[model samples]
Target: MNTCLRPVAEQDAAALFTLVDTHRAALASWLPWVAATHTQQDSLAFLQHSVAARQQGSQYDWLILVDGQLAGVCGLHSVSAANRRACVGYWLAPPYVGRGVMQAALQQLCGQAFGPLGLQRLVIDPALANVRSIAVAQRAGFGFEGILRQHLWLHGQPHDAASYSLLATEWAVRQPVQA
Candidate 1:
């Protein structure tokens, strides 16, 4: 599939909300904010916040398009410019799952992170129980670091998370050498 990442725009609120609403149960199980996104307005607010954050050099979010259709979202959050590190987050619609769409999107994100973004490190912290998410990180060449106890609170309960990271050096070694 032709996978691409488009910067999130105000006009995408409806599409984003529809995806979250349709997958509320599954998404809410892992993401605490999912429960609060009950309407298009909430998604718009999120997009607005993302725009502001991007402008402030704090966070960046993008819509994942597969074959020219909205399929999911991916972003770099919890950015630390001083430390040159950031954490990655992503999710795909049910129909797009298992197709390597997220994996490809992540690779592209990594390229930007390690190249123009001038970031040295990127991390993915997936709840220990989230095997699919962990797999995605592994597929994108992130090495497992360790488990963080109560790293995330979801659905009113704390959950352990498996931390994974990729450094720019590692990513460079994985890339094809330019001719």
Candidate 2:
């Protein structure tokens, strides 16, 4: 299980599109943007936007790789410089599910968010019924903040979401003590 993350690049548009297109049905329920990605061009636009966002210090996205295969994507979005916080989002292909791929990817992303990104709070809001996503957050040491009724609108309908948060201070406490 050699898993890693790399910043999303323009050249990855085709591969990203293929991954999303193949898992559209499974991802559409949890990720709203999956429905809009009907073509490789749409993915290119998304990758381009991610690059721009990183430059503007608004967001950062990365492609998840497991043994050199594009397995998914994860990112920090809705970044607020003044607030020093951001929301985390991710989706994985079905083949990589239940193998701890997302868990490792998420920890790495959170470390970036709380470290050099200089963020204080990291948020993850998964639909209430998305047990797998919620578990990822919990397993990564995020605390259950509360539920936001109808916090997310997916497939033209409002859905309740569970809010989880990991503060930089909390994350720091979880880190191993240095020698």
> Among these predicted structures, which one has the highest lDDT?
2
Kindly state the number of residue pairs that clash in model 1: 0
Q: Could you tell me which residue pairs clash in candidate 1?
A: none
In candidate 1, what are the lDDT values of residues 9-72, reduced to their tens digit?
9999999999999988877777888889989999999999999999997898989999899998
> What TM-score does each of the candidates earn?
0.97, 0.97
Report the Cα lDDT for residue 134, model 2. Answer: 98
Question: Scored by CA lDDT, what does every candidate get?
Answer: 0.92, 0.94
lDDT of 1 at 102: 93
Candidate 2 lDDT, 1-179, residue by residue in tens: 98899999999999999999998899887999998899999999999999999999999999999999999999999999899999999889999999999988988898899989999999999999999999999998999999999999998999999999999999998888989
**Candidate 1 Cα misplacement greater than 4 A, ranges:** none
RMSD of each: 0.8, 0.9
Task: Return the lDDT, model 2, position 44.
Answer: 99
